[model samples]
Target: MMYNATQKVISLSGGREIVIETGKLAKQADGSVVVKQGDTMLLATVVAAKEAKPDCDFMPLQVDYKEKYAACGRYPGGFLKREARPNDSEILVARLIDRALRLLFPADYHAEVYVTVNLISADKDIQPDALAGLAASAALAVSDIPFGGPISEVRVARIDGQFVINPTFSQMEHVDLDLIVAGTLDNIMMVEGEMKEVSEEVMLEAIKFAHEEIKKQCAAQVELSKELGKDVKRTYCHETNDEELRQLVIRETYDKAYAIARGASSKHERMDAFDALEAEFASRYTEEELVEKLPLIKKYFHDDVLKKAMRNMILDEGIRLDGRKTDEIRPIWCEVGYLPAAHGSAIFTRGETQSLTTVTLGTKLDEKQIDEVLVQGSEQFVLHYNFPPFSTGEAKAARGLSRREIGHGNLAWRALKPMVPVGEENPYAVRVVSDILESNGSSSMATVCAGTLALMDSGLKMKKPVSGIAMGLISDSATGKYAILSDILGDEDHLGDMDFKVAGTRDGITATQMDIKVDGLSYEVLAKALEQAKRGRMHIMDKITETIAEPRADFRPFVPRIVQMVIPSEFIGAVIGPGGKVIQEIQKATGTTITITEADNKGYVDIFSQDKDGLDAAYARIKGIVAIPEVGEIYKGKIKSIVSFGAFVEILPGKDALLHISEIDHRRFETMEQTGLKEGQEIEVKLIGVDPKTNKLKLSRKALIPKPQKA
Candidate 1:
């Protein structure tokens, strides 16, 4: 079949080529586009689900990241030799693309949209992720997906704190932050990034810069869509008596919902209040023909009541349901070194929110094995966040890691990575797990604080101890109504205008995450939030310090120790061979990293250990770049060899000496029997003579038999 389409190609200033084509590809799917930047290519296709996934509160959107290996000139590895499980990088990339799309999708619509990005090439210059987001937006634009899309994605980087858009891979290594912002021209949907503790003002400015670029891309998408847009076919939203039932619920439970939202100060009370309201609303539905039908009525009632109560409290009363000023924060308490078995352990609690973090130290062998872009090897440190059903005081099925868990873990990981040591800098392989015992607000930030304390407890020498705080801003009320609260409770976050989490050392910021439902605010509000966060963080820091401010004097007994050393570049090959043959030997013998890096004609090898003895053994094993000590030093020795010229003797560990013929005996003897020395013999010898220049040993058996000859 033939298709009518319009295409545009733009060569950006940095040799980045953008190919925009629509209507030709994915004619059946809702929207699809092939975005090519230099040689890197990605095919982003968007398809909306015909019907909503039942009872799913969240928008059901699926984003997949597929890497075409032929693009990288390599075939997949494994028996299947195909992509199977989603690699961490793929999951993260798909998530990155999903965040941008989620915000643009219609809010009330539950129909699902799936965005799949397939990498056709891996250009050494162009980045795949940047192009993926751009193409996905284009696909959505041309296809009749029921999305408020046409929003664009751009990467904002800071080099020496100066922001740059779409930096190359080489330039990225020097950047302090990698920020990706995806949003419409007028409103922002989402932002995710890693910062090197840049100030809030700088981060805000960078976001602004990214958003401005997004505007231009959005316009481009609009033009492209107009040229080749298709009619979007949308299924009717789930058939429900939403409006009528919602009104019935509001009329029946307005007071109860308000009471649940506004009156409850604690988690348990809130649950009780919500249950009471649910029970009260269920009374009206008892007479339904079908008993199961009551469930639907209660569900509708539960949602409407919750929504009204919260919205009324925020909009009308101007009082947060949590009873805190818009700028007020919940109380905070912190403790470190709480776990005896861990290298480090800490518990940070803000109001009802809590996270218990434990740090385990390990040998380089403990480094997490990962297969991902940017980190194709092992990682020295890993931060894992876990949310159990019990954490919310609920009885629910639990087993696998949900996407929410992975996303939260990753968020905490990115927030704390900058403060972690790098290279051969730290001797410990750190793995921290943050267990969210309870969460109301900013539990991830609490994890950061707890992780820091746990690291210190393990005896790691950090450049500085770090702490984190969740800053909250309530939007309503012009004057005294707005509050910049520190250590916000969960209710504060739900009711507040924004959630701004900042973490870093006392000297400066290390990491931050900001999300708000309200319109983007000016720099002044952000600045104030940051200032307040610091105060809140410091207060928590003091409490942590009181228990164990610094890393312990020693690592936990279960934790491992690591030692590093340098080897000659020439020795690198001797230590590691083709396909890691030699390195494997070292690992089998010493049980350590034995990692090698060469620069400026020099090689460095880092070794790790769990005990002093292991550390010593690893050192001896890899330090074998040179032969053992020289042959001759007068001392007791073992006869390892018995040659006619003399005998090869053991002088020291891994060292052998050849006893000269003349030194073997005072009388001239041509036969080995005349020397009366057997191969298994051990004896003391005198160093009557030796050749230091040639590393040859001359042992005197007859001369040392004692002065009888002289007598």
Candidate 2:
């Protein structure tokens, strides 16, 4: 028998192992790997397109990590019982892998890289996410495609201020932090994870530990690729040589160039100055050299081309693109109640980025239910962000929530969740949508600011108003220079190395997002950016208050009104009878949602109706259902099963009263002959002093009789 296959397996620390065999499967793919641990196995196959998509400005790198129910030895439930769309957790994992490989790909080369991670097993201890990233990188490395040598993914867990490297599912229980960082051997490129609000020191330590463990995994992948790697062709992107023209340009106009970069504020001003500078530099060169030197010099100095300016802008001089001084904020304009039809609406724009947020408040029934791998719970406060192609001066076909969009929307959602008011008193389901009509930079942060205003405009009484700003770091390795720009603009962000966004209230930070395209940054950079972010956030908040200081006194007229009420145990049956007949009638008549939270001797009823107008109407409408004894009121009574000493009378439909035989006819009724009273007889009775303690109404029929005529 002839076998066309080979196999390789490597064991890792912490009872984890990477069992890989490539020759046995998918040989047609550019590169592929099957990684398994126990029953949990993932087959990652990658293929790069021979030709790039037409009319595409950027490379098409599609990384999809999907989970099949059958892999877990189960079938998907429900009609249309199949897996179609990727769950939220799947989208997040796909994004993590995408970040890891993007840095390794060459800049000029635009090719399609599809990494499909199919689950062939299901062992909870060995999560496929970290391995999926490694497998994707390995596929690219072993393929004929050119990439910078090996990137690996690492998962870090922290428990009690201690970092655990490549932690298992069991260790995650005690962990307050879950961070997955992907980086090359030299530095990190992507970081994405969720934390339970841990300290910065602990967080930093965890990242460090993750990087260390990742190196070993990175090593294993390198070894495997060497054994089975295909010959990869190389394509290099063209870069200008700044040294060749630096001296010439400097001698000609260094003094002038410095002035323009320092003094420029608006983008147009910078463009004008850069154009003038380009012309001056081009004048000093010969026609052929001019063609080479002009672009080289412009590339080294212009906003789009020159990235070293980050260091110059930050370290040498604390000059930002918008000309804000250190610890200063850009212009912030906030307007609440912008949309009349929405429950709550606000528009928050800081500098170039803008987010129009609208809040919709609904009953508990309005909360969305999500069934996913990572989370199976109910969420009351939801924040959604939408970034259309036009927002960034681009045009493309419409597609549902992509990885980038989901990640950004989730970041904004986390930043604002802690500020939402909660508990049984205000058990409302709130949703905030921030439509990014324009995005220059920090659109995610803008969503936070606008969402806060919208919630307040809807009279949500949020715990605190939140504002966010995007901080950028521009480093010049040559001069050991660095600059941290507050509220960075689009051009600055695109050219800069790091996009650090911070959001919170005046007191402390609520959420933060950090993404870098450079080597791993020092804690010093993170600390400085965070400190500066506070200043920027507070400044923006000061501006926001000028527009709307606090939440409105009343909720939006269009929003729903929810209230909680308690009723006696005896009335519960009358309110909700056998098969919910009474409750259904109550809902049909008053158009309210009555949910019984706790029912016993005392019951709590949660009522939800649209607006205070509807709420007040329902309140007046349903109060009579649980009607109690009221003094000085008259009610019809029926003799129901009369007794020897007193007659039991039904009053007000459901209430009952006692009639003594002495008052049967203003005199004694001997053997029930003189009174002429029968069962099911109805009569009008006068209400006396109702026992306030018992809530029972007393009535007297003799008092309404002709007693004055006898006197």
Top-TM-score candidate index:
1
The residue-by-residue lDDT of candidate 2 on 550-659, one tens digit each, is: 88999888876788777776777777867998677767777788776443577666689875566665565446567876776777788886777767777754468776
Segments in model 1 whose C-alpha atoms lie over 4 Å from true places: 1-5, 10-13, 50-58, 230-248, 289-305, 311-319, 373-375, 472-497, 519-524, 572-638, 650-657, 663-669, 676-711
Largest lDDT belongs to which candidate? 2
TM-score for each of the candidates: 0.86, 0.75
C-alpha RMSD of each candidate structure in angstroms:
4.3, 7.1
lDDT of 2 at 545: 79
Per-residue error at 590 for model 2, in Å?
Answer: 1.0
Model 2 CA lDDT for position 162: 77
Cα-based lDDT at residue 567, candidate 2: 78
lDDT by residue for model 1 (368-407), tens: 8865432346788898988888887879988887766777
